[model samples]
Target: MAVNKVKKVFGCSECGTEFPRWQGQCSGCKAWNSISELRVSSSPQVTRNDKLSGFSGMLESKIRKLSEIEIEELPRLDSSFDELNRVLGGGFVAGSAVLIGGNPGAGKSTLLLQVACNLSLNETILYVTGEESLQQVAMRADRLNLPKKKLNILSETSINKICDISNQLRPKLIIIDSIQVMYLDDLTSSPGSISQVRESASALTQYAKKNNVIIIMVGHVTKDGSIAGPKVLEHCIDASIMLDISDDSRFRILRSHKNRFGAINELGIFAMTEKGMKEVRNPSAIFLTNKNNNTEGSVISVLWEGTRSLLIELQALVDTSASSIPKRISVGLDQNRLNLMIAILHKHGNIQIYDQDVYVNVVGGVKVSETSIDLCLILALVSSLKNKSLPENLVVFGEVGLGGEIRPVSYGQERVREAFKHGFDIAMMPKANLQKNKPDGLKIIYVDKIEDALSKLIDIIS
Candidate 1:
């Protein structure tokens, strides 16, 4: 056994900031008692091997001109799931590192296993887990009814050891069930510390690019819905994807925040079932319910998520408030935006809601943050306060400005087609978004101002 030199260090628990010495408050985040003393290994550092990946094996280094350089697009390894592929910007690009962060029991492992199995039909994949045993992963695979292939699974945590195995196998793709628990053998800090998480991810990323292997690493999110590790982990990754699940466990939304090759804010819909995650082909049907289409306080809204348009229902309930200042409550929608929309309704639509307790929700627990849903949100609030139901098939989507102007949104044609496919007859949208060729089944009701849309809705409801 080697003697590991240990030194006293101070680290912030809240933001994972390291301090040279102990202090009452963390200077980085300004939190009390957030700093704690830690014993970290100081010496016997894990140095990089230049010859490991031919970085030092090449002779005569010479700078080449941009035109002389050969550019080759890396091949994509399809996971066979279009939802995953689309979110990943087509597929897992060779020699790229993709990081996935999610809450516990959010189907991170299940989705990775499913992907590995799907790709194993033609390529090599290694699924490594530091938190679970081989038997546990095997049981999960069995429960998901995953078809057995050449997919390999390993129960390990040592970063060096896992890298050695990866190099030996030269797998086309590798997955670290989690990067948080993985630690370098020479790092003094324990696994999950700020240093360990950051260093381990850096090493893994370098290995992926050097070996031409795709690395998919799992990460856990903090309380504020951010990756728990150091902020640099996200910066170092080729793509940063998050999987969010609602309380009811009906569907999971996969969102890509950072992608080197694909578009950002790309969304993928999945339904959690006994057989693992199933892709939601049509999100409109899942988010909108026509059963209570005629009910008061329910307004149909079309939201553009990624390249798809989702038809969702905004339900608002209004009642007398006991307090002078009414409480503004919202779910799956920004409270601040809701408040702004309510203020606009009172100012422009002559709908006074200052003393009423307003509660708004997006159906199916789906979150709608796009400005295009602002018009529908205000419509739902006004309809609830007046106790009237708008048209059954009326679909509203457009941004509402403080001056009562209806702003146009992108992908207007796609939103209209999505609404028409769902049997929606009339669409109340911004006048500027009206296309020359409209779908046969849908009637576009263009409104330039909030008052115009409100007048149209109030006429039908009254």
Candidate 2:
């Protein structure tokens, strides 16, 4: 019998720490119960015959200087959906890996499957699903009623088999239903574990790059809505798309969390229908509803989401509270910002919010992080409390500070243009943003303070 040589190997899978032998705890990384053992091969690893033959073989595989490398820039392939194409900076690039992550039932699969069906013109697409069965995908395809020509579906969980299929099919585009369910036979780790996800993603990414195939991987998210699995999985992808689901099921928004080839903060809006997802051409109209007339505590604000412009409804309500501590609740808008705006109202405008419950919300179930909606929210709260209404066809947008100054928001011109396009007769914005040459046929009301804006709207307020 051959002599067996036992080797002691220690490593922490999470922190990548190596030790002399397996320990209950990893001292280098301070992680308990993370150390694992791996058998070391006694024989030297095999090398290619060319490497054994030395210098001439080395010359053939010599590293090229950076200057000698050809720097050709390849363009991305345009998808049939203009919104998706625009967000991806003109289209999906060959051999690029993309990660799409979102909450459960956030339509990540639906969106990607729609793209596959729409873009299957003359290009072969391989849709591999580990989570769903072949029957489930078939049902979805039947519902979509897509043409049955170029799209192929494979329900697989084995990484090795998937790669083998990819090699045999040589698809132009490949989509993995999810990264969590994929497993490798060589790895001892179970599927969806950190190690398994990382290894599977690395293997798929390497294969895609080598074959010049566009690959999109759907990823499951944590409870906090972040992508599940190790952070390394995200780092390996070329771009990341985050789909946001609102309380209202009518609208779904797609935002780029990371993009190596395109602008970062781009937003795409889609309306979910019985016939899959449909792009919303004019999102402003959908955002601004109940358009018969304007009421108290309602103000229109133009918000910029990347290159697109959206008109948002800012609504606030102030009522007397029965308890000692007034309830302050804000949805889709920051609660701290609402408090600060109330403080400014108390100090500058002599309006008291103490001992009162304040509720603020952005309409259409959309969240607004920008400070530009500050002035509009404050004015809306005041108007609602006083039981007064602003102008019916007027829009307001500006940032409010603790000092009661109205700051100019970015893309003020775009905001005004969007408002005008939506048939608003007048726009109230920061005085600092007034230009010498403004657009024709639109009234501009400039205000330096929140109180100044209120003064201009007093005609309708009374």
Candidate 3:
């Protein structure tokens, strides 16, 4: 009698590379102990005699005419957080899979739990946790002061078990605490391995689509602030949001990077409290500092957070330094952008502070990526260099070009209106941005060049 020998294949957990045999180091990611036995597949795994049938049968495909199709609004479940609603583009769409990634202690779990409790009022919610026990979740619920509601809690990591229970219950919404710790038992890799994460996500996506259940999955982030596991995980989900906190800031920003159903790059603001994550109603107000005081190196810029307009203060400090090479330190604003603006000021505005150490920070740690704040940044640098304090009730926003020309930005009128609502009396913007329909009760000051801006706002006219 002849005996059959089993052959095993190994896979890299770090980079999802597969190997026919085990290796000490992963050839893909070069990480030690990251490679592990994946599975044992017999050479004659599937015999011709064995018929592949059953399953859910085959799926039918169809196509429809654009004019014949009826348009209807997608149903969304309210998460009870307006800020979250904004970032999610109205609310959590039914049957949509949302993968939220964040660092540990960044409130990814807390935010999801909070939303789960809120949704349990009208919808049945299943909260699954692979990393924590039932008792641990209960303790957190108590700490959060959550009501004893119809929300179901399950502490299992097996993807098969999760799917079975989720399908049976058919809950309106399902919240998975963290997807990294989930795995399919059939796979030989660890829970956090790349294969496990990918398979688990695929299962969740299928479950949501087939059952019409909204699934919210929490994902751990890498040290670089990117979602853990394969980059494909983000693409697999209907929407992906990230929770990020800046160093020495109490505020956390919920930013949506991928959304198939709605807008992308939408933002939500939240503040961490002892109770739980509290959504900030007026996020722009939180970014303002010492509004009454007129300080040098401090200037306000209008920022567009999605469709909403926000007034953010940019603070800069410029002083003579002993070092031959002047230092440029920028936080929450692009360093390259600041450098270009500084060079623009030198060549165009004839305002030179190249030999001085400069530091620019976006107040309250709110990251501003739009080029609309360029003129405001240059103004802050000019104020710092000239030791001039801008008027306390002034708001400035415009795109500054390399030729020292100020350009128009989108939604300029809305920016001015938001600034005025926040008690900003004076609005300084590009002349091109001042359209026919302007807001009332706001002092409008238009300028075309960097020199014009400086001469109009500050005493440094030379």
Q: For each candidate, what is the lDDT?
A: 0.85, 0.79, 0.82
Error of 2 at 24 (Å): 17
- Per-prediction TM-score: 0.92, 0.84, 0.88
RMSD of candidates 1 onward, in order:
2.8, 5.4, 4.3
Off by over 4 Å in 2: 1-71
Clashes of each: 1, 0, 0
Clashing pairs in 3: none
Ranking by TM-score: 1, 3, 2
Q: Tens digit of lDDT per residue, candidate 1, span 387-408? A: 8888888888999899999999
lDDT, candidate 3, 140-210, per-residue tens = 88999987477888988887788778767879999887899987755555787676788778777777776
Per-residue lDDT, model 2, residue 387, is 80
Q: Which candidate leads in TM-score? A: 1
- What tens-digit string does per-residue lDDT give for candidate 2 at 1-462? 565454555656556555787788777667677666644334333222221122211324566799997877866876677777767777898878889898888888888888887677778888998888888877887898766467888999988888788879989899998999997665555687666787788777776666778889999887767787766788778889888886678788888878888887787888888878889888788877654365778888888887888898888888999999999999999888888988998888888989889888888878788888888888888888988877877888889888899998888988888888888878888999885667788888899986787677675566
Worst 10 residues of 1 by lDDT: 50-59
